[model samples]
Target: MKYFMFLIFVLLFFDAKGQCCLHTDLSRKFDYKVIRLDHKDADGFARESKIIIELYKKSDKKLFQKIQFKTEGIGLSNVFSKCSDDRSYITGQNMKTEILDGDYGDIVIADFNFDGKEDFAIKYNIPADVGPEYCYFIQGDKGFKKDEYLSNQMLWFPWLINSKKHQLISIVSPNWGTRIYKFQYNVFSKKWRKIGNRFFRHDEGLDEELIRLKNI
Candidate 1:
């Protein structure tokens, strides 16, 4: 019995500390790639990861630009299993990069700051209780600069981009009802501001309803 228990404990120890590392493509724009490294602490919690972005130009095969950032723990958002008596649970969260094929285009491209040039909208699943938040890269003469304005804004999951109007819409339900918030870029202030909102039923799709109502 003692040997059997020891073997089980050893297995769990390694299983909890499993690691993953890779470099993957994120967009078709000049073939941007992300280098991701995910590590877990001894207790099996996601510690942090290094995410680096590399953009290359095909003609010369030259690395044009690079961006790097570190991930911070967003805290536990999920509970997989719970102990009946104590209610302790196993939770998991990671700041991993999105896997992309040749044509899966989830990235939003728009002139968010109304500069007449295209900018990229990327979502990051930061430490959050609900869903993923968003950030953007504004196109510049050299490459792109991270927009601090949108990065500091607070928004929640189930989000969509309005490319025509340069808007970001998000929906959240804390309790029994849902609240919708629409954010638009203010060129003068160089920030995003909430422009509109509405309450809707769970059955209705927030993205679809927002598009319809905003058109009217």
Candidate 2:
């Protein structure tokens, strides 16, 4: 019985040691002031990770809002290196630039909907040739809500927002294709619309070379 108990204790100790966490202060970046990421160490990756986001009122420094979500895993080395440099898994620059450069990070902070409120995207899956998939959340009067349109259409590939044109652009890989979606308000229906999708392939300096692709 003593030996069995000792073995059990050892197992528990190793299990506890295998679990690690990374955190960052995002107060300057978004309303969610801080974020904590928890995961279990793998051979070369982290698995079963959870991201916890917290927001505080600036005036009192009191807790205002908290959100948590899960991810399958991410590259262990990448997460650790980024965390060591800044204690954050989030990249400091624009996500569009990183994606265009073929560098994918853990989180992206941006104003996704042109709502004047900041939004964010979390990398929740391993990246493919298209790029890392992200869970996009939009900020609202209540709180952040997962946006299906953005998550499905825009977050999968390297994308950018053009506030001046009210357009979102996505660049597809391998063939170097492009997709553009426009957002506009309709005076007749008294509703906002996300319409006018256009696609183009690598021009190759010739109009005939342009290939029209189906919507992704």
Candidate 3:
């Protein structure tokens, strides 16, 4: 009886860690197909997940490249709130057809390097007082290569790209600061440069009355 009990416990543990659901984004606007496998607990909270992306030739749907990676899981509430209209949850024998609409899923598709090709960023962590952390994958001649600079330097804050200025603009709430990173290429050195600038809240003319004298 003890041996049987031990076996059951082991099964339960594996089940909790291995339970996964499927989400896909086959949007025609994108050149590649994206599949997201979310590994969740019994309560449906994802702790770890996998992403599979397949690049295909538009002419005949021929597979060009396949890319896969694993990253930290996203909360169920976050997924539902962001992708409720575009994603369909699937598990086991029950399969729901994925709706191909706007850019959905955990991945953010954009041209981070300003190379005219769409690159992607996947959320890997959510630090306290900061925000979500992302792993950037830039498109290359061979395939998507992980970009350490963007992944490490840029925290996933409320951000946008300024195409005219060739800059990445992000707002960090904790420090109430705005960061701008200008992207430039050097022909002689054959390297890229990211020049960053920070504008603190005080620089933006914060009201002195808002701060208490005791706190200051």
Candidate 4:
């Protein structure tokens, strides 16, 4: 799924690198390729193309295309007004956001609270006319409820993936000029805390990653 991003970034960059704006044709490699549609922001294209590719990959084609995208960390929005900083994790940066899972696009089905059955953490698209995207944690029965988070703009960009421990990891963006956020399962605490403010690829220990981010 991570490689899914290369589709938009690489594709778009390819076009930009071209001198004349000749009608760009998809130069097929026979093997699946990553193509980014634009330079500044490929959210619109990413949102659409990613779903088709992922759906085809999961249901019909290979689980992951020839060039598998290494899933990145989750980008979270700062939902709290009092919290300050005012930033939400951006999703489209690493991967695209669209509903390949039918109703849930960038969502994970798991027992986030650890009660057993399973809960959910999903990113929502603030209406096309609204501000940036927002993420929510829905507990059993209660369903999708809004929380005070980090993201303010309505870019609604996020990607959900099951990690090595079968834990759901999300690579999300809160707002413009912000890095990604990694939310990990605190086995002992039984809750999700934003780890490694803006992360790139997967890391074994979140604590170590956070320290690295801080040092940088």
Candidate 1 per-residue C-alpha lDDT over 52-124 given as tens digits, one digit per residue, 9 for 90 to 100: 5566654554677887665454223221111110100011111132422111122344555667665655444
lDDT of each: 0.50, 0.50, 0.50, 0.32
Please provide, for model 2 over 57-167, each residue's C-alpha lDDT reduced to its tens digit, 9 standing for 90 to 100: 545545556777776545343432243222122334432332343334455566666656766666666554555567777778887887776666665533445555554
User: Model 4: per-residue lDDT, tens digit, 155-216?
Assistant: 24333333344233333322232244445556576555555455434433545754554444
Q: List the lowest-lDDT window of 10 residues for candidate 4.
A: 19-28
Q: After best superposition, candidate 2 residue 165: deviation in angstroms?
A: 2.9
lDDT preference between candidates 3 and 4, better one: 3
Better of 3 and 4 by TM-score: 3
Off by over 4 Å in 3: 1-31, 40-45, 73-77, 80-105, 128-131, 157-160, 163-165, 175-194, 206-216
Model 3: pairs clashing at backbone N, Cα or C within 3 Å? none
- Candidate ranking under lDDT, highest first, comes to 2, 3, 1, 4
lDDT of 1 at 193: 80
lDDT of 1: 0.50
Model 1: ten consecutive residues of lowest lDDT: 83-92
Clashing residue pairs in candidate 1 are 74-127
Regions more than 4 Å wrong, model 4: 1-115, 121-132, 140-158, 163-168, 172-178, 199-216
Q: Ranking under TM-score, best-scoring first?
A: 1, 2, 3, 4
